[model samples]
Target: MKHYTSLLFISSLLFCWMFISCKSTQRLTDWSLVWEENFNQKKGFNEQVWSKIPRGGADWDNYMTDFDSCYAMRKGKLVLRGIVNHTQLNDTAPYLTGGVYSKGKKVFSDGRIEIRVKLDPAKGAWPAIWMLAENADWPVGGEIDIMERLNHDSIVYQTVHSYYTYTLGLREYPKSGSKGMIDPDCYNVFAVEMYPDSLSFYINNIHTFTYPRIQTIEKGQYPFNQPFYLLIDMQLGGSWVGTVDPKELPVEMKVDWVRFYQQKSIK
Candidate 1:
């Protein structure tokens, strides 16, 4: 009888340890890489992995601008340089800028996504790395903003928009006063872990926020179950970041790498 009791206790302890380890591994930073853009070397963008959206004043997320010079390279890095010009109304001329998306090429369903990037501190420069649902219209398919920074404010925002609700909302991480100018020179990592019932965000391996299942739509309406593509861009100005400073000529957002990971399912 004692032998059997000892065996049962041992089993319980093993089970508990396994459970705790699993919970820890589920953390946003703990996921292992399934896909990655290291941008280790090379020059120019990888056409197979990215698609440029071209220059247009479409007011995406209240941003105003016709076009900007945006570039991507096979080395895995993406660069967006802002130019200032006095030629045309939307012609923030001399500036090289624009945005890129993994629209037709890549999309993810449920996994961990991470991007390592640097932002340009110039006023009116807005940079973001985010995701969009694969469906035909937006907000209807859902939008997940993993990282977005307003240059003037020196603050970053993470947000989600879903058709299940009609409200616009966001969670923010503002830079401390002592941090000084938030610019492209200082690199940062932004990441998200997506699960069936929840999603979480992390900055440089530090867990910052979590959105629970209660805030999501029902299973049938969950647009996140389908594949979603990634986007990286820099906007000149608009409602959020305000207008670009006429004096601040060329500004750029530099990206080091973009990576994706998935946890192994328990069989």
Candidate 2:
């Protein structure tokens, strides 16, 4: 009888220790919210944090515009629209899109960035949430594409670009990125957790893939450890996404919120 009682007490103690260990592990991995934008203001996007992405010669932003009709704030959401250019007869582009960047206003590093958004499908709609280095130029600096949806795709692309991947064409060597399934009709959460050694991508809280820094003589194998600014845009008629159908013009992408988080255990 004494032997039986001793065994029960030992088992109970072991169970308690295991429970505490599990909780501690979870706590260490948990995140503490650092900054967030809910777009709850009655006016447009907070100018203190965002600015209209300038029109560039690239196919992606050639039609980028500062038109009032392409941007709106409704019911705590930032709405970016891509519309046919009937009203803007003076503007040569056939379409105008709305986009904003935190280039000079806000920047972050070594943390997780998440965006909750819903996209409306158009024949040539391309909406993206991405990050770019604050000071460095293209390919060499690095590009982190948290989420990019082309047309009516049910899956979004999460990718990273660097000199190694683009210039040297070493895309598959270190696994540059991945694509994850998403719901076309409803809002989905897309996130990228940036660490000094790796960038982890997730969709709807499901782990999609991780791109790690490996030992290499390549000059720009991992340039993502530096500060980066965020960009969210509603783009249309890109060569990769094909031609726009005027019948489906005026499509929009609704952004519910954006958040940045750091590990709770970190300072």
Candidate 3:
């Protein structure tokens, strides 16, 4: 019975991979790849394109650690590790995790962004591929979440936050029908196409959510005009994601690639 169950699980994963891989190419054929991080090297990433957080930066109840060991590269992909009480580092957090950002080098304007990732659904895992404004203050600068999942659940959350969404109490949750369900155990594509007028989110190239420009609200939600940088993180546990189970130690978020593209202009 166990062997048969294993085969079934493998078949499901293969099906998911086939569906996701084909959809990514179909959706992005119109745009040309401008910048991409394939995570090719085994040791250290391209310092010019990506940067890591050496120490966990946390002022709230969430755990953040600066230990570099929480990250690694395997099979030509970047792996973000989350572990319990990473005692090897001087970080004071109860848990140690990994985070990386494309802040200075890879900030981009309105375009297409795609990330291929595989997540472990162990309890207490909060993995996300998101973006933040290059300038402005918190809650006012704007945040675009391409994908975020909590506690190994199947739902993928895509949200936009700004002064308007904050005052409206819609930061933590979406404005309804703005989420999709996905299989985290297999590689899936999460994408966002940011236009001057609106933003669209997708899972495996399937349109799942959309956020339009709220013009009537003034600067309440208009902070998304400038460039934004990408951030990929594997958070251990927090207020919204709850607590991490110590037994589910050494969980990881595997990222195959992050590619950015721009639509070619016609002559």
Candidate 4:
């Protein structure tokens, strides 16, 4: 009788645990799909939603170009490439990379966004899918790096940077971000759920980490509650990722699709 009672108690506890686990994951399913992209057209991305990222002096965008060789739509995917300057005889930059941003056309707050991509690893390749505040300057407003894969890393980094983290350097307490292992050769889903109080990151639907808003008087500690725009780029030879290996030129990042969802209660 004692053994039977013990078994019954254990069964009851297991059932409760499974129920709670399902409820927790059901919170994410409660979101309603608001926007999505499949990249079905061949004339590059929808201009109404995305604009070619302009060249900048910064390493990330220094090689950004709208050259034909840098962008393509193949097999229903958006392909952004980083290639050695073999064409554009007039251009002087040794490398040219493809990038796009949705600043004015699409901006959202307090929502979940997911991107499915396949990263091609190369010695100097640095591909990223990230977001920045639409109306505020960088580091001041905040930067949310959903995914950043450097070189041939088997894991992708998901990070958040703000004045607190970058200027004041207060990242140790809250731990701004984390890394997740990924299959370098296959498509992986990188996502983030941005709320007014915290940001939850996930890789392939598995929760990785969460950066929560902490009680502090510091500026930019949690500036992610505002609307932000997206930036997807195929970068090469950045200071963080080191110098480019010419032999590894023509690397690419294939984006299968992107989707944005908001809490069902939002509207």
Candidate RMSDs in order: 11.7, 9.2, 4.1, 7.0
lDDT of each: 0.66, 0.92, 0.79, 0.92
- Compared with the true structure, what per-residue lDDT tens digits does model 2 show for residues 49-149? 99999899987799999998999999999999999999898899999999999998999898989899999999999999999999999999999999999
Better TM-score candidate (2, 3) = 2
Top of the candidates by lDDT:
4
What lDDT does model 3 reach?
Answer: 0.79
RMSD of 1: 11.7
* TM-score of model 3 vs. true structure: 0.85
Where is model 4 more than 4 Å wrong at Cα?
Answer: 1-28
lDDT of 3 at 131: 86
| Cα lDDT, model 4, residue 33 | 90
| Better TM-score candidate (1, 2) | 2
lDDT-wise, the better of 1 and 4 is 4
lDDT of model 1, residue 24: 47
| Candidates 1 and 4 compared by TM-score, better number | 4
Q: Which stretches of candidate 1 lie over 4 Å from their true place?
A: 1-30, 61-69, 72-76, 85-96, 165-185, 215-222
Give the per-residue lDDT digits (tens) of candidate 4, residues 54-158: 999998999999898899999999999999998788889999999999999999789999999999999999999999999999899999999999999999999
Using lDDT as the yardstick, the better of models 3 and 4 is: 4
Candidates 1 and 3, the one with greater TM-score: 3
- What would the TM-scores of all predictions be? 0.72, 0.89, 0.85, 0.89
User: Which lDDT tens digits does candidate 3 get at residues 15-67?
Assistant: 98798768767766778888888999978878898887545335221454556
How many clashes in each structure?
13, 0, 6, 0
The window of 10 residues in a row where model 2 has the poorest summed lDDT is 20-29
Regions of model 3 farther than 4 Å from truth: 1-26, 54-62, 168-177
